[model samples]
Target: VERRIFTSKMWSLWRYGILLIIMVTPSHQQELSSQVLLDNISRIVDSRLAILDMRMNNIGSQLNDVANQDEKLMVRLSNNLEDKLAELEKKLLYNLEVKLSAIEEKFPNNLEERLSAIEDKLPTNLEEKLSAIEDKLPTNLEEKLSAIEDKLPTNLEEKLSAIEDKLPTNLEEKLSAIEDKLPTNLEEKLSAIEDKLPTNLEEKLSAIEDKLPTNLEENLSAIEDKLPTNLEEKLSAIEDKLPTNLEEKLSAIEDKLPTNLEENLSVIEEKLLSHMEENINQEDRIQGVNEMKMNIESMEENIIAAMNRSSVLLQKAGSTRCPEAEGFFMSSGLSRQCFKFFMDIERSWDSAVSKCLAEGLVLAEPYDPVMVKNYIATKYGMTGWTWINGRGSGSYITWQRSEGHIMSDIPYWYSGQPGSSTSSSHCLLLMTRQYHMKNYPTQAFYANTCTSKYYTLCELLME
Candidate 1:
């Protein structure tokens, strides 16, 4: 192999080198002078160019032959390649087609032949037989029947022909007569349904079972429950013809019950409401509400008066009040509670209170009964209330305005008891209701009620 390669390389070099030498040796030299030799070399170069063009044409022809031979390889590789091509085609089909088969398929052979093949697969007997039945249907019914006929299973044509022979003549007139005579009496309708009891009802019901809604069986079962003792055997005989489960049949029976029951129930509710309104006096209820409000306000004023006296005593106690902050008010405040910000966060309740004190608010303490009532009203609006430790008598819980120390004074426990749940919802909160404590807003999951041990709001004479 080594010798063969070396010999081949040398031979190629020799062949090319000789051709080059021949081209360089003047091909058209006439007089052996400098100018003539140059002219001869130019002629030789032209000859070499012609040969190069011929060689290139031969290489191109060879390449075309090689490409033709590769066509066989394409077929062998087609297993994987065809699958990839089909995948691409399916994607394209999905993009373009509302129904893919219509886009993906190609018609083969004659259109009439294809149509004939398809028809051959269908139930020949039924299609031909349906003509007589179709003649009996209403105009609109005929059209709908034709549309449905196209979709049924292939054997339908034969079965339909057999059924056609069994049907009564004058079908259209009979249907119209039946529609016009729809039962004026309940007993008549029930009797009609029983009289028409088909001999092949079991087979018919079995065929229809898959199409019936689940409620049908349930309705039938319920009818069984209400059936009179005298009619038990008769009803059971009919029930045995049903195809569905007991529950579904009972449901179907109830659904078919007369509409009179619904109308009667509506009439009863309206009558009851009319009677209730006639028995009650509207004026008495209004008078009771106004009296309760007047009493509460009077009690509230008395408590406020006492708080003023306590404020005077605190002044006399010589506790130096710091200069009032920007929003500070020594007197009663506007009704709305405002939000405040504290820069520092602390771990413990006592530390939080100290932080609030530094910021010029007190752990809120209510001074008077009105204050207690107001606080009660406020906490109800909030999720819960916790007693922030502060100074106050039963009359009022007052926030020491200078720094957070004084707390609101209010004692409120639900009339019955405290309820701690599975997670030990131990602490009590006074969730302030929207209309004082009367309207309770349901708490959201994340609304943590204030606890005594938790960080709480400080009432400030705000800056």
Candidate 2:
């Protein structure tokens, strides 16, 4: 009875401890403590301990399997990453070699040869040409001016005399005859006749004299009325017969002859002498030619400096290290972004986007469309329609990557782009040189249906 009581007390304590463990342990793990206490409590405890040990062994083996699987997965992933890195490194090295060779070819080592070639292209007969021009120029401006002045007055007098001779000779003759026929002593003769006359005879003669004076006035008026009425008209007709553009010629001559002729002539002589001196001075001419040559050489040096700066910039930007194995090429201009053309692979807009994403790139978003066009022209020559990153309906377009609103003011679209059919056209397409056919500007944008299949253009962002 004492042994049984002692066993019962131990069992009760063990039950309480198990309950405490159950309360503290997680619900998933609490199922392991399911063995019940019996009258043979020692045997029951041993059996329960064996079952717990076996379950713990099973759990550890399962944990080991999971750890092995995880390690294998990590190892496979690492190997894949390493392979990709090695491939990328090889491609980069190959691309670098190719770029270095191209640079070497484009810009040779011997600058002296280039300088000599440039010198050969320069004009050699500059001094000779200048001398020939100087010889052809007028030297005796003063003598020429004086000669013109001397001939001017004589020509004018001769022309005036010829015009005077053209006037009527009968006019002068008529005037002289009228003067001769007029009575200079008519009043004196009349007075003498009046004195000789008797009183009645004198009165009658006075009346006759008054009547004769009235008759003489009427006769003079009649004679004046019978004279030439068209004298001014005849003179006008003679003036008209002189020349077709006679007045214009005279005005031009007047304009050519300066009002201050002597002062103008002296000024012209000074200017001519100065100009001749400048041209005739062989040393100065040679110096000017040398200066021009030096200027050209300086310009060449500036060009070379600019090229070196550009090369340095290219190195800094990593533009020369484009991923050529992936068919990517560097764009021209300051952006220096890399691009790839998948001409053979035609896909819908969505499919194209997927393809670009898979390649760790995005659809081409050509902010500088002109530079993009030039790059395409230089490398590809010509191409068919291709996909870009623009997507929208109507005038409200946006870049797929940046989601920035497309500015309509930019001249990136073709003549009739973003077409009227907005319902069907919701994606952007690049119009190529082949599509333009030299008619429209190449690489212009055009709206097309999202489902339409076209060549893809992908852009790899710069780090």
For residues 1-463, what per-residue lDDT tens digits would candidate 2 score against the true structure?
A: 4345555776887778778768887787776643432334567656666666777788889999999999999999999999999999999999999999998886546768867955774456757757965764456756756754754444466656755765665655544554444445444545554454444543543343332322333433443343335544634444334344434543444455546765665576568546444543544333323223334323332333333333344345533466877568776544466788787678999999999999898999865565566556555766667788988844677787766655443345565555655542488877766436344432267788889898888998765
**lDDT, residue 62, model 1:** 97
Candidate 2's clash total is 0
Q: How well does candidate 2 match the true structure in TM-score terms?
A: 0.31
Number of clashes in every candidate structure? 61, 0
Residue-level lDDT of model 1, residues 122-155, one tens digit each, is 4547665478546644556656567456545465
The stretch of ten residues in a row with the least summed lDDT in candidate 2 is: 284-293
Q: Which stretches of candidate 1 lie over 4 Å from their true place?
A: 1-352, 368-381, 384-387, 390-413, 417-430, 433-455, 460-463
**What's each prediction's TM-score?**
0.21, 0.31
Tell me the whole-model lDDT of each prediction, alpha carbons only.
0.42, 0.61
- CA lDDT, candidate 2, residue 259: 63
* Model 1 residue 311 lDDT score: 34
